[model samples]
Target chain A: MTQLRKALRPSTKALPEYTRGHNRSLVLQTLYRDGRRSRADIARETGLTRVTVSALVAELIAEGLLVELGQREETRPGKPATLLDLDRSAFVIVGLDLSEHSVFTGALLDLDGAISTRVEVELAGSTGDEALAKVVDLAEQLVAAATAPVLGIGVGSPGVVDLGGVVLSAPNLGWNGLPLQALLAERFGVPVVVANDANAAILAEHSFGGAASDAMLVKIGHGVGAGLLLGGTPLFGSRFAAGEIGHVVVGTDGGAVCACGKRGCLETWLSIPNLHARLDRPENADARERDVVLREAGERLGIALAPVVGALDLGEVILSGPTDLLDGALASATVETLRNRTMAEFHGSVTLRMTALGPDIVLRGAAVMVLSSRLGVS
Target chain B: MTQLRKALRPSTKALPEYTRGHNRSLVLQTLYRDGRRSRADIARETGLTRVTVSALVAELIAEGLLVELGQREETRPGKPATLLDLDRSAFVIVGLDLSEHSVFTGALLDLDGAISTRVEVELAGSTGDEALAKVVDLAEQLVAAATAPVLGIGVGSPGVVDLGGVVLSAPNLGWNGLPLQALLAERFGVPVVVANDANAAILAEHSFGGAASDAMLVKIGHGVGAGLLLGGTPLFGSRFAAGEIGHVVVGTDGGAVCACGKRGCLETWLSIPNLHARLDRPENADARERDVVLREAGERLGIALAPVVGALDLGEVILSGPTDLLDGALASATVETLRNRTMAEFHGSVTLRMTALGPDIVLRGAAVMVLSSRLGVS
Candidate 1:
């Protein structure tokens, strides 16, 4: 038994080199999750040596980002251990969600993924310059309320967004070729990441909500859009217009015209505005009548989505936007249509769920985008 | 100076741990391309030590894959070094291109990616089981003729191919839910890989042909399909039907019905057979008249592909399969239509070129698929 143990052990005491950065990340994650722990306890939990753990802990403490919390009780040990934890008031991030009709801005963050502070402001105008001013003004308010240093800003818009923070096109917003990232960066004097609103919402759900696994989040509002998560990473197509399922033609004829100059688009009949328009007859002008229109719209939405659902074999489909408009009967009708159109083999196999982040999903996802890009954590 | 030289020398005599496998691959690739080299020559070119080169060469030779040639010219103050080269007869791979009309089988290759043998058989019936039997029989004949050990078999088909080797739906071939991989594997008692034909062609182009950069290859033969290569890896959508651009509607009305139960599909207007039917009068049929019809068909094909050409912003579009049908006039029309419909900014920016792989592209691609799968290179 002694010989076998000796044989199994490596001859040298030197640690493998590639695992250094990985071990550092693990230690940081552990400290973030557990608050504070003694060096010996960290070693046992992470399967790292005391010497390695002590070195990392000492380096972090020296950086002023983490601190030692004195000694802990010695339990069946020769010496007491020093406890360490992340300094919670280290940094904060700003999140912004820009839409055609509204602009939402907020800030809430922690090293271990917790909300510390949040603020939102309604936009009086939807012009490009006006929207930008509102975003900066709200960010300032959030910054004033924050106790931690502001790290960076993350903004989510509705359009074909490139990695460089440019909005190539946003039909609903009547914008074209806007350098959104450069504007935000110039305003705040910090790193800014701009992504599509639907893409950001999916990221939020994937990171913190029920649809956290490999899934697809479809945002149904003024225009239909989708964000795809494959293998835990967002998939951006060749031209960044990958998730524009709204333009896909589901009906051959008699479908409403779309803003894209195309007829019979999925967005034409399924969008909230279109549904409301269809239901605003003289006889059905009340809220109760509007509810009936919303339900019918959901049924049409499911029919349009059946091919996509069958094609991707996605595990979950998450919807977000105007909970009042997407109520129980509407959602149930959408599910029923989806069930009827999809292959029987996959019937009852996929889950259709609602967003958990409420109206703040896009904002939270924007914050998450900043946190992930700046700190290398998701 | 002596002390400095000693200090600069690596502490460990073995290859650097940082990129050992990568360096080994580089050496192997060099030999695969240049045929043979001496240890001193390899050291001079690869920046590797003579001792390290000698160790790898010895291991490869011992594995009965590499051969040691006679002594080469000596430039050092010592004896001449032996040259090493890969054994050309090490192994062989079978590539099969299964289409709706015919089946093409070929061997590619060892040392040189050249076809060793090839055979084409017309299918009496287009059933999955019948096609599988024909493939198995031909593969056995090739295996029996080969002097070297067979590595594996690769088949490229048209449809939604799963990683599990099932053909989900091949409408053109009247196939659905066919276990192609298992059928071939059980019959031949060898490893088999099934891939989408368009995807296979794209891989071939990316690895060996001129469309090596980030490009999209649209194979327009009996059917219209697209293969996208982004960052050198095939982009399979969440549901694996990502590049199904054939079904995208190009015409609003007065278009022929597609086999997929759709009207005015891009495929109905763009396919070779449909194009020929539209132009050729059966009463006035002749070889010269057939050429005219093919040329006219190419013109229509260009019109159908114009939107796709604009949407993806592809650097190059490669057309493969039956070049005789897609001659210069057809190509020019495609270029002309693409120029007119695409965004003005990208006008004359995209290059439309015929496939460099000839008629045997799909066959060659199938062989490459087998090689990559077995070697785990892709």
Candidate 2:
């Protein structure tokens, strides 16, 4: 024992202080990914012992985060096994989706990932402080109405967000270097996560909606953006500004000028506002003519995305936001354009589908953020 | 006992059957990621028992793949510990880098990740089968010359590589749909991993070179590509072709045609060959000298990457491949261009540096692939 202590000194010195917490998080994450399990099963999966699993489970249950579900049937002739699962009502999380036109706030439930008590507030003007205040106010109301302890808040915003929670530049909102996360955290007295809106949408789709765990979620609303998910995790580029497909120059000469002082950006051709402007001609455009124009706009969106699809070889492409604008003819035209432009081998390998979350996708993603943070899974 | 048996039954029944070898591989992976430690440390880190770690270590040591060192000192007032590490001389891995113009074959050491031997073979005007045969022959010779047991071989080729090791395309090499992995594996009597050259380069940079645990590795060789690393894991887009930045259209019209049949691709404007063609015209009286031309080329490269830098918020960019051909005026021009084009707030946020491994970055990445696959770390 004395020799063991001496021998372990070097390793112990090198060991990070956060190892214990990380280990616990790993256990919780494994359980979360795999669902209910016995102590022995957890031990086997995590490479821990039954004793360690028992101790951890006990600690978790004591914290009201987990619950034992009594004996489960055994195949072998042995002692009955104890099953453990996350306590469904142990905690709740708040998810807020802040868009240029509207704000959505909701509660993401524990265990089952259901959204409860959701509210949508439209923005009169796209002011940073005004939008933030609306979000905070809605959050307070939701928290007051909550039956379970609220763990944290996750806000999905459009634009470049730093790790410090500062919105560096959101062209749509005209926000730059705003300490959004800090302000929200101070107000709510809980941890706050600020993510790119498209990234959050991707997370929502991957976790609960139609996008697979490895899909790329592209949101073509008032703007064009993308969120890349690999192995159930969002891929944040070095500066946390990955998946900005809007600014990827699609045309160099004589294309619509972008708000970012660039010409021929995908957003210039694919954005809802741009499409609407093109279709809403006061000169002589009927409603039926407008529908044809919108359908053509969708075809253009597909043409713009075809190169990206061929290059990335992504199997799933999910579209979200303003379904009325992207329905029927528009959807089919987009698919046809993609099919025509992509490689023959990848003809049917890619699936383009509308988001299944209706209007609550972004909000659900925000809730997922809070849940992920509380559970230390992300 | 009956209750315990009943409870355990479901878990036991539901648990997927995994082999002992797989568990052993997981143990090795944990050690590789967390570094050297005692059996207790391995068990603690991996959630396995000390007994299991001990057994695996013993087996590995007996197999000459691991070495047990003397006891290490303990930080806590407990038992001293035994230290175990991978034996550097136990095994050798062959890495191949198949670029457009040249083919580099090398043997990389285990544990320390040093290059044991290297042979650069320029691609002759030959058929695909001939080139493959030459690679196999070279690998055979390297394996025969090595003092250690050959664990595996890893090949980095320019193409879309499927899980089945098929090279979907290699326009430069004139190869398509080649079953490289299976052929190499069969010929060498060991596991072989075939991956995209850019992906391998990123992997090498992430695991053993400049990108660190979290960074995006952008390879600006004959074509522009990106490799994303988030939380020490590579982000393979849904179809395993996520980093095809070369095909990203950078101009709207009147640009050089890309091999993908697209006009104004980033690669068309930024690749070395393209730069040489654009700038090196002996007949043109007003054309700048070679030095000035290279600088301008670098500026164009930076311009092409500015949007990516802004969008991804990348911390640093590592420049690989023929530094002599890419350094001086071109490099400085690139830096200046990046600084000027990116948002002012993001100015100086990204640092550009030469790859640490020089031209061998791809080969090193291939070696990393073998290490990761065998250890199951990444």
Candidate 3:
């Protein structure tokens, strides 16, 4: 380590503390991405001195964060080194999703982001304190059911959530200026993270669903919203309302009024309830009529997104909603509309697809929030 | 420093090289933002050790990057300390703006972002190799005219420029996959950066125009384009087409044709030539009629930008264009349309105003590119 420091010292002055934290994250990230490895192997992969790797590995093991996975099979005469890996099953993460139209869902997620247990509570038109009570109850149930120690808790709620985990507003849940993270942390005596549902979903798509770093995930559930991942960081915006595209009017030709008292808002066209209302009308009984309805909704969505796509030069657009509603005609229309609205030579092949994570995307994303905050190894 | 490190050591481990670079930038930024300061003052402001600050200052002064002013005059001081500042006049940056319709402009800029010399060359319908040659010739003139050592060269061109400074496509200039940066660097023997004019404009706005770290600058020239600065970093999209919103179809009710073979594109409604064509029509003679035309054009711009504003929750939208066309009625209409089209509660007060930099925004932005890349300061 000293020799390495000397060699690099000509251009780079050494500041030991920052390097240690960065290297620690690098070590965990390496194991998280590439699986188990011997200390020597980790050192080689990470370009860290073998001594440093050994010390870090030992410290991690002592903290119960890593497990010795026994020796590796060797063809040579030298004794095989003991393998080490993250203790993935040692702790459970509590994740809650409050973006659902009818129920609040909670889950026990392992470090691997796989759900070990699931629970849900019907909202039953709850609001304000009642809604807060239900969220607490659901979290309590998930915490009680965790098979291992709780690592942390993360909530993906519908609204503008600030960096400090305050839900600034969620009209559906009647939340305003709610310090959700602080409340949960005080009650559970653990770290807590809270974010917008769409934001959480984008993180899950990036971490688990193989989405690219610069991708936008549009969440079209009870409300229409989007989450942007640019250059590997989620944009929270100046007002913590990044991806709040639900109420932005789409297209010049106005349509039905939105809940926000606006005409032709994206939500009026893309929200599940609105889409159902438009498609299920008695006058639109034929399959061709339904196709047209979905296609129009898709076109509206494209209109709302085309400027964003062009402005950001985004390459991927992931739709997170009921696959039945967003697939086929609607999805195809969105692609066609985007291609027509934007410059073909510049954004000719922007990919638009449905997320495979299903409704659990927010839940998994919540887990990622906890993992990233608690261990910095998501 | 050791005591501070010990206090922070429990959670943060040290990595010398990364912290050194970070601290170097911190020092430069502190002096850049706060003006001249003593070593003690810099240490206090940046939380860096006096030893570290002294070493960095000495190194910077030796490199001709920092200047030490006379000792501070203080009534209470027993011994006054010398003040340090960036050597703002020691280097000149060459900036080129190629987004103009009929002319290419160049300037020599000091560290304070002040232009000391300016020059231009008429396009005269030049394209392809001829245009490239003109750009080289202009750069040579600026380099020769510099009164100080040339730091680097930055070009803000009208095209989809890749991260490697290659012009992927600029139909107006008939450039396709031209290695602009490499060619200029080889000819000038200095670092060269080439980016889309809009991207460069945004950088200028952030560094010199007092724009926020997370803001968008719309450059309306011969063509319409935008540059985004999110979280203090310029966003280069997956295909380097970020901020290519010029050709996005603004309204479903199509009107005039665009050069991209699209009708009612934002360019048709907001570009210099298009706006002039619509407003300068002989039959539309009255001021009210002119207001109506400009207002309608502004509404179209709002329609194109509302989705982007909502998606990113941007707070500031600075327009770079002819003030006569974008100000007053047009600017007001754009703001009004945005309010009507978006969630008023969330984006009610988004500021949309013309940039104060005028036509020189792209040129200054080009200088910022070189400043930020070469010195990690802007």
Candidate 4:
């Protein structure tokens, strides 16, 4: 921080307008965290006055963000109080993931995080403008199919993203300095968020996958990258490129050359194609043989993750990619290696698991971004 | 997050009492961040009412927390405004660091982070109750020599500290579940904080070292550990053992055994003793040979940090140890290795530097913890 910037920065918080919005967010967040509750229950949980809760609840109901589901079924109550819940299906999120190498995928997800509609467009040869067009089209299709009003659009694209949602560079998509947020916001007439794919994945894990509020997600597919969440929020570094781990050099000297001109880079050792080449699995390889190969890959991944686990004392490490490649022996190897590499004390408390969100992890992550930015629930 | 806990937790913030204290803290923090300024200037920067600023300023002045620095020379102004600054010498802080092995040290620091009194006690054979007594004695001696009102006491010990400042365990100090906070608070009749030594170093780096708000501090002594900061806050994971990086295995298999029964833990490779053993500098060794040995140590350290940097997208790696061992060739090697291991693009922005605060880094860190916990400055 520079002296000039420090001089300009405010020490006191904002006024009542900001506080009011925060209070409103608290009410909505309470509803999301704790399901169906009476007005009195909400007031007690929120520490808001009865009158304040009632007013906010009324406003939320008027905005279709909440609904009264009649009286609760209490056995020994003189008068059953009315229960309020989030109007889960009243709004839908349009989520897109462009991380996949050959296709652009999208979906419409309800407030409950369930996908209601899905669409995709092949991008095997599409580049630059065409690829951007494909993403816009898929999102448009999902928006058109939504049964309720769309909340906003959230995108998980492959590349270095700026704070303002511009794609600084996406080598595979041949994009550089694209103002994706402005373009999509203008086209859809809704707020839009564009972030790195792995970052989106970690958000999904925190928002819905029951992963620890503070966790780490390592996505190993055509490329390897990580997403870090600390204290329930994504750790976007000073440059907003905090989780780009693919090109880390793992060896002291030459083994295989990387596109980044570094020898023995982690990408050369862990990416899907690299692993496949190293394994040399025959078409008829048995399960045991496959496990051995996966174990090797997983061990390498763990070696890479040892310092990270030790440095952050992270509690969870989520693997997201092909289940066939990451689960079973591979996942076990990664966990065991992490246990051996970092302190044994951290082994028991730290969790290692494949993502429960399955193959649509990035798409669901997009939905989580919308939830965080649009509704402030995440 | 469990459903029952979610239901039980209150969603709203504390009432006006907490808000009032927070506002006062904001005002003090503004003075600290922006240097000397007028009440009107503080009010404008903090977005607080002039009346509120006046009331808070008057309270602080009465409390001896602020002092009028007279009028500023302003050529463009018709009348010069009076300046207010932190009463740096009005209060003194007692800080203790237990990171050293054979000795325990304590110091008294003023508001400007400068030490005034120094004290130490030999712990060659001290352990358990005796060691605790020595610590208490050292603190009392420092307190007795203070020239002003003692603000509080802070301890940076080696252990897994709980939120309440209980030492879960500090093997070297032979402490376990020691209620240090309550004990010291009772003895001194003032606030006290006990945290892991690395965590304290990180707080110091954040509070006064001009380090980036989000950064890491690596202290290599008898043990190797790191302290992490994210978004201006220390990254204390659930176990409060977030920065314990000493036992991270640097080797895939056994080369040497660790005290913790792990083979080739990071401590085995990076501790000062281990580095000296590896270098084995003959009395007549040439400078080039010594450079090679230091370079190798630095490269090894960098390899260990590769995944951490990649996983966190960290751009700064600060090394704290004997300058003779950590700077020049060794620091360059670590920087080069980090550059090679992580993204080359990140290499341009990443920083690798020695501690500018010198050997008292942890002691100053103790003072930082006092400031943060006692006054909520961090």
- Better model by lDDT, 2 or 3? 3
The alpha-carbon deviation from the true structure for residue B218 of candidate 3, after best TM-score superposition, in angstroms, is 0.9
Each prediction's whole-model lDDT (CA): 0.66, 0.69, 0.88, 0.80
* DockQ comparison, 1 vs 3, better candidate: 3
Question: On TM-score, who's better, 1 or 3?
Answer: 3
Candidate 3 CAPRI category? medium
lDDT of 2 by residue, A91-137 (tens): 67777777545544455555546777776666667476766677778
Chain A only: list TM-scores of all candidates: 0.83, 0.84, 0.96, 0.91
Best of the candidates, DockQ: 3
Q: Report the candidate with higher lDDT, 1 versus 2.
A: 2
Model 3: lDDT of residue B254: 80
Q: How far does residue A142 in candidate 4 sit from its true spot (Å)? A: 1.6
Instruction: Score every model by TM-score.
Output: 0.70, 0.74, 0.96, 0.92
**For model 1, what is the alpha-carbon lDDT of residue A187?**
72
Q: Encode model 3's per-residue lDDT on A1-378: one tens digit a residue.
A: 232122123464566544676677678888887777999899999888888888788777766778899999988889898998988887889999999978999999988899989999999999999999999999999988987778889999999999999999999988999999999989887779999999999999999998988899999988988999998899999799999999999888878888789898998888999889888899888999999999999999898899999999888999999999899999999999999999899798999999999989999999999888777777
lDDT of 1 by residue, B1-378 (tens): 232122122222221124444445556666766866987777778777677777766755655556888888767777777888767677676777775355545555543456877766667765666666677777777777776666667787887787767888786676788888888888876778888788888877765686745467778767777676654667565555545556543433446766766555556766778776765668538776665655545545554444334333456768886676675766777776555444433334667788888766776677677656544333
Candidate 4: docking tier = acceptable
- Which TM-score does chain B of candidate 3 obtain? 0.95
Tens-digit per-residue lDDT, A81-194, candidate 4: 999998887778899989988888889888767887889899978889998999888988987897777788899988788878899888888998999988998898777899
Full candidate order by lDDT, most accurate first: 3, 4, 2, 1
> How close to the true structure is residue B149 of candidate 4, measured as C-alpha lDDT?
75
Docking class of 1: incorrect
